[model samples]
Target: MTSAAENILERPETARRTRLQELWLLFKENRLAILGLVIFVLFFSTAVVGVILTSGEDPVFDPALIRLQEKLLPPLARPNLETLAQGEAPRLGVYLFGTDDL
Candidate 1:
């Protein structure tokens, strides 16, 4: 007669089947918990992919354009006289929802 431990060790497929059966039983007993886990994983994957895709390029500096008049300006601040006289809308990088404003 074979021992119980020997029988389990002899069949690797049987061990996998046993584990799957236990998981199925647990899922059946806690359906909502399993569903919540699936939803969380889906949202986490979407957020990670979005961050990877939407990052912007680095800004280049122009030493000639760096005048004392424009020093210490915050981002998306009002445009200087040159930009206004040229009739060009101030380009504040991408807005979250794609509006002209910052």
Candidate 2:
């Protein structure tokens, strides 16, 4: 029931698919493209985790929670009085990688 134009359009479909496959193989061989993909995956994972932790009323990671005294302490340092008084103590009890500047 199809016309001549439809027949012509259908004929090259396989050739087009083959060409796309060849193009993809060629693209994968490029080192720069591979590096870009790795960087993309690294940042993409962190972004997803950040979104999940920072969502809703009680965030898993609160960006505004700052204890000035705890800022420079090394990882696993005990919670001193200044940081304790802030009442926003890190739930883990020790900073995994320590706190950075607010």
Candidate 3:
């Protein structure tokens, strides 16, 4: 019968789908794996978005322009109000993740 033939043809696909569903259920049972998956997705999306947004501009930063005088500053080293008044701080934005000069 055509119904029997259709069932036979679909059996392998149904088995494969059941296996994939079982694997997904097993994966969801692990809290740490879920957290890691979330973190990975966030980082991956951030990198992809950053690349797209910066595509028109220079892809690489010229660290050589970063002066020796301005090197090795800690993160968020905001100038004091007095220093700002005196115009001592670099015109660049806040150092959110500290300097890369070690």
Q: CA lDDT, every prediction?
A: 0.54, 0.78, 0.63
What TM-score quantifies how close candidate 2 is to the native fold? 0.63
Which lDDT tens digits does candidate 2 get at residues 1-102? 578878898775554457888888998999999899899999999999889887878997687777776678887876776636655777777676677785
How many clashes (backbone N, Cα, C below 3 Å) per candidate?
A: 0, 0, 0
Alpha-carbon RMSD, candidate 1: 9.5
| TM-scores for the candidates | 0.33, 0.63, 0.48
Model 3 ranges with Cα > 4 A deviation: 1-16, 46-64, 79-92
What does each candidate score in C-alpha RMSD? 9.5, 6.1, 6.7
lDDT of 3 by residue, 1-102 (tens): 999999899876534457888889999999999999999999999889767644654433233344455556687765344534344344555655456664
Instruction: Give per-residue CA lDDT, model 1, range 44-68, as digits (tens).
Output: 9988766655454622322223334
Q: List the residue pairs that clash in candidate 3.
A: none
Model 1 stretches with alpha carbons more than 4 Å out: 1-16, 55-102
